[model samples]
Target: DVKVTQSSRYLVKRTGEKVFLECVQDMDHENMFWYRQDPGLGLRLIYFSYDVKMKEKGDIPEGYSVSREKKERFSLILESASTNQTSMYLCASSWDRGGQYFGPGTRLTVT
Candidate 1:
């Protein structure tokens, strides 16, 4: 069974703070994705990595960045946290066109 783990379940940060959210997948998936979910906008991909040391920006990548140093770990970085950046952040991993397994999201609150 594939298992996904996130560094934090809930996070609270002030504006302008740098935040790091980490995700890990047990299966050696080749694809990892970072997405943010809001009320009306639905799931918006922030960034994704196809392989180690390779990343691509997704639909919304203005204030976010990603790193994939290992096949099983992917990190999401928020350069400068803002109030509007507060949302439910999700991490998913997949391989060979199989469905992705998502981690328990991180609810971030920026005030």
Candidate 2:
């Protein structure tokens, strides 16, 4: 079975602080993605990596960055978190176009 786990289920941060959200997958998937979910805006992709050290910007990448130094781990970095950036972050991994296995998600609050 494929398993994806996020470092935190909930996180709190102050405005302008840097934040790091981590995700790890056990399936050795070749693709990993980071997305942010908001009530009305729906799920917006932040970034994705097809392989180690390779990243591509997704729909909303203005305030976010990502790292995939290792095959099993992917990290999302918020350069400077803001109130508008507060949302539920989700990590997903997939081996092909079939489907993605998602993590529990991290609910981040920026005050």
Candidate 3:
């Protein structure tokens, strides 16, 4: 079975703090992605890595960065937390052009 796991299910931080969200997949996929889900905007990809040390910025990568050092792990970093950055973050992994499986999601809140 393919499984994706995030380090946190929920996180609360004050404004201006730096936050790190971790994700690990069991599938050994080459592509990993970070997305933020908002009510109307739906899921917006923040960043993605197709290979180790190779990353591609998605539509909303302004306030976010990603790391993929190993085949099974990927990390997301929020440089500066803010109220507007609060959203449900999802991590997904896929085998070369295969179906993507997503983690439960991390609900982040910034005050």
Candidate 4:
């Protein structure tokens, strides 16, 4: 089974604090992505890693960064949490053109 797991299901934080969201996939996927799903706006990409130690910026990577030092793990770092950044964060993993499998998203609230 293809499994993508998020480290946190829900998170609450104060403004300006650094936050880290972690994800892991059981399958050996080449593509791992971080995205946030907001009401009306749909899912927007934050970052993605196609190979270990390699990363790429997506649509909304201003407040975020990603790391893929290991094959099965990926991490999302939020430099300064803000109220505007409050949303559900989803982690996904896939192979070449493989359909994405989602984690049980982390709902982050920046108060």
| Candidate closest to the true structure, highest lDDT | 2
Q: Estimate, for each residue in 8-107, the C-alpha lDDT of model 4 and write its tens digit.
A: 9999999999999999999999899999999999999999999999999999999888889999999999999999999999999999785899999999
Q: State the displacement of the C-alpha of residue 92, model 2, in Å, after optimal TM-score superposition.
A: 0.2
Better of 2 and 3 by lDDT: 2
Q: Indicate whether candidate 2 or candidate 3 has the larger TM-score.
A: 2
- Report backbone clashes per prediction: 0, 0, 0, 0
Quote each prediction's TM-score: 0.97, 0.98, 0.97, 0.98
Backbone clashes counted, model 4: 0
Per-residue error for 57 in candidate 2, Å, reads 0.4
- Position 70, candidate 1: lDDT: 93
lDDT, ranked from best to worst: 2, 1, 4, 3
Return the clash pairs for model 1, or none.
Answer: none
lDDT of each: 0.95, 0.96, 0.93, 0.94
Q: With candidate 4 superimposed using the best TM-score fit, by how many Å does residue 83's alpha carbon deviate from the native?
A: 0.8
